[model samples]
Target: MPGRSRPIDKFAAAVGKCSKESAVYGKCILADYNNVHKDKCAAEFMKLKDCYLAAYKKR
Candidate 1:
C-alpha cells in the first residue's frame, strides 16, 4: 500500500474535480450528515458512495 491513495484523499480529489459549487455542496452535505436523520443520511451516503465508485472507475 506504499503508493495507494487514502480514501479521504481520493474523496477530496474526486470532489475537487467537480464544479466548485457542487463540490462545496457535496462537502457540506457530508459534513452535516451526522446531524441528519439516520435513514436519510444513510440513503444520501449510499448515493454519494456510488458516485465515488463511479468516479474511481473513470479514474
Candidate 2:
C-alpha cells in the first residue's frame, strides 16, 4: 500500500517530475549570477514555468 505523505512531500514530488526543466533554468541563472540582467534567462524561465504549471495540474 502507498504510505501517507506530507503536503511538502507531494510538492517536492511534483517538482521532481520537472527536474530537467528546473535544472536548465537554474543553469541559466548561475551562468551569469554576478551580473545577470532582466530577461537574460527568459526562454529558460518560460520553459520552467510551463513545466511547473503542468506539474501543478498533475498534482
Candidate 3:
C-alpha cells in the first residue's frame, strides 16, 4: 500500500532533484577548474567579452 501525493509535491520533488544534480556537477567542475588548471575557466570568462561586444554592436 502507498499514499497519494499532491501535484505540488510532485513538482517540488522534481525541482529539488534537479537542483541537487546541478549542485553536484557545478561543484565538480569548479573544483577541477580551481585545482587542476584554469585555462578552461579563463576561456569561459571570455563570454563577458562577447556580451560587451554585442551590447556595443546593438548601440
Candidate 4:
C-alpha cells in the first residue's frame, strides 16, 4: 500500500513551491534592477524569506 503523507512532507512541498515561484520573481526583478534601475534588490530577497515563512506558518 502507498504510505500516507505527513505534516512535514506537506510543509516541505509548500515551501518548495513558494521558493520556486519567489526565485523566478526575484530573478526578473534583480535583472531589471541590474540592467536599468541600478537599485538595491534587498526587497526581493526579503520577499523570498517572507514567502517561505508564510508557507511554513500556513502548513
Best by TM-score: 2
Candidate 3 TM-score to native = 0.29
Top-lDDT structure, candidate number: 2
- Native-referenced Cα lDDT, model 1: 0.63
Question: Runs in model 2 with CA error above 4 Å?
Answer: 1-10
Q: What would the per-residue lDDT of candidate 1 be over residues 13-42, giving only the tens digit for each residue? A: 766555544654467677877685546455
After TM-score superposition, what is the CA distance of residue 39 in candidate 2 from its true location, in Å?
1.0
* Local accuracy of candidate 4 as per-residue lDDT tens digits, 1-59: 37877878877876786867677667867676746454356666667778877777776
Q: Give per-residue lDDT, candidate 3, residue 46.
A: 52
Error at 3, model 1, angstroms? 14
Per-residue C-alpha lDDT of model 2 across residues 1-59, encoded as one tens digit per residue: 38866778767877888899889998989988998999999999998888877876777
RMSD of 3: 13.6
Q: Give the Cα lDDT of each candidate.
A: 0.63, 0.85, 0.51, 0.70
Model 3 CA lDDT for position 30: 77
Per-prediction tally of clashes: 0, 0, 0, 0
Model 2 TM-score, 2 decimals:
0.73
Ranking by TM-score: 2, 4, 1, 3
Q: Give the residue spans of candidate 4 off by over 4 A.
A: 1-11, 19-21, 25-40
Model 1: ten consecutive residues of lowest lDDT:
16-25
In candidate 1, list every pair of residues with a backbone clash. none
